[model samples]
Target: MDVDTEINELGISNTVDEIHGAHRIGQFERLKTSHTGRETLKRLGYHLHDTMHATTHEIPDWISRALKAPIPKNMNPTLHYGRRLDRCLNI
Candidate 1:
């Protein structure tokens, strides 16, 4: 039998749809994580230094809110993390 016939006989056509659906869900999850993970990582203070190096100038609004400070006029907004962390550590 052909592939379609074999798949139908095995009642596995739904499996293909399920796999595609799972892939779409995974894509959405990855997008969400990529967008939100930075803020989450910063909040927990796990790897602030590394993240500062990796981040760009386009600071997301959520990050500013999370940091409870406005983004500076400089190109590298992430540099502010040092002073922010210092204040937090001092308190």
Candidate 2:
């Protein structure tokens, strides 16, 4: 949630992370036409895969709605984690 739009020269949204290395899941329609945009996203996937040692398999189309991305979902780890905590507390 701390991410802000910075002036980008190479990729869409031009995020600070893209400047440094990490790319984001930006506008899907734009990425379809932009080579640099695809590179940015591909790089992020490679790095994440290298760190995790697993392929994503395939991103479901529904994931596009989670636009708070690169932040909110990672912060939670999994929805099940939250559910477990709530169950423990009988909430």
Deviation in Å, model 1, residue 53 alpha carbon:
20
Candidate 2 residue lDDT tens string, 45-84? 7332334233346666687666444565446557579777
Per-residue CA lDDT of candidate 1, range 24-80, in tens?
777644544564755665575645445344445987999877885555576474768
TM-score of each: 0.27, 0.20
Stretches of candidate 2 off by over 4 Å are 1-26, 46-91
What are the clashing pairs of model 1? none
User: How far does residue 46 in candidate 1 sit from its true spot (Å)?
Assistant: 28
Lowest lDDT 10-residue stretch of candidate 1: 46-55
Instruction: Score each candidate by Cα lDDT.
Output: 0.66, 0.53
Cα RMSD of all models vs. native, in order, equals: 16.6, 19.9
Predicted structure 2: lDDT: 0.53
